[model samples]
Target: MSETTSKYKAPALERGLDILELLSEQDEAISKKDMVAKLGRSVNELYRMLAILEARGYITTEPESGKYRLTLKMFELSNKFPPMQRLLNAAGTEMAKLSEKTQQSCHLSVLHDAEMVVIAVQDSPYKMGFCIRLSARIDVHGSGSGFAMLAFQPEDQRRAILEASETPEPVIESVLSQMDKVRQKGYFIGASPQISGVTNISYPIFNSNRQVEAVLTMPFLTLNSDSLHHQVVSFEESRLAVADAADNLIHAIGGCTPE
Candidate 1:
């Protein structure tokens, strides 16, 4: 409540923040000498700030080269806020429930920089199943979640994503027909041509604008298909489970279904 405390500032904290901001703008690490040149500060001035940041696990220094770059701590912290945090909380719960019931590995994906990035993954309840790593990027045309998202998006936006990739993402008649089917059926169920014995089932999660906000996918697999313990889940069963999960997720986050 004191007037002086409200206006008080820490110059050291400000300098450390400046370094973090600068490092974030770079695609690669920055050397101490280069950092000084870019920051227009003496080495001594920034040395302590760098030391503290590194010690606190905010920035990391390369062993081979004395260059420094930011760590994932900031990104992890940021995911605790808006849209993404809200999404994770809701999707995690739904994905867990889906996986438990279906005994199938599932993941939540979002379109990032023209690619589908897996944000969260839930393992199958079975002893043997596959789980995708967090932050893995998948091809827009080749992945179930990727294709599912693109199928629901506006045509122009989809076109832009395809055009932006240097390697031409193949557009085939079958894929086109499948997209039409996905839109019509409200879900996608198909075998992944790239991965044998793995079926990809995807559902679109909507936002307040009734636009496709994310894709919820189950990379279905049979562990010991011949084993009498596991019962085969039908395509219709998978579709309904994923669809219900998406709907429950929408309610959790106060979102809408696509129009």
Candidate 2:
């Protein structure tokens, strides 16, 4: 079956939520193998979700027993995520509009340490399009999402954000060289360094505090010559549209463009 129509998608997400709900009722560590059995799924099926949970600190592993257990960190983060939730709620429709207008998929990403975490995505209405996985972590130095976010932050914060990254020296220098150009243009258009035949166009979303909180991106694809959607909009069209959409969302969430 095609990935978009696969029955695995819904249940896989259900399984991730199920793990947290099950663990919240337990007081002790549970083995991975046992969780597998309790989950009624193969280890391979649960591996990715479990790793994401562990990395995000919703669960912790015991070194002695190598078992997993719930942590209060998720609760702590839940308290701080209301604003983020608000942004997603406000931006959803606008993002869908962007996809409809540009015939390209777009995603919203924010800095998490040195990585960019995709928090929201809207797929193009076209039969075929790019879509980034929500909660996916992207390398900050080599990605357009990273460049948009990095270029907009104030100088001090920019340095700190860059310092946290462990990108190769050549890549770091390249990104540094591109910062001013990106800021001057007020958007970034770069080759998807990791994905072939895709262009990642990114713009920053600012808040009333004048802080660039998130990057909004459109991964415009190079369509097959025989593709259904011909005469797709140019990169500049997608760029300008996303910039306006980002600004609208910023205002929707009580933010303003930085001066």
RMSD of 2: 11.5
The residue-by-residue lDDT of candidate 1 on 63-151, one tens digit each, is 99989999999988979778778889888788989988887889999998778988899998877787888878888778888778878
Which structure among the candidates has the greatest lDDT? 2
- Which candidate's TM-score is highest? 1
Task: Please give, for residues 223-249, the per-residue lDDT of candidate 2 as tens digits.
Answer: 765655477777777778988898788
Displacement of residue 202 (Cα, Å) in model 1 is: 0.5
Global lDDT for candidate 2? 0.83
How good is model 1 by TM-score? 0.73
What are the clashing pairs of model 1? none
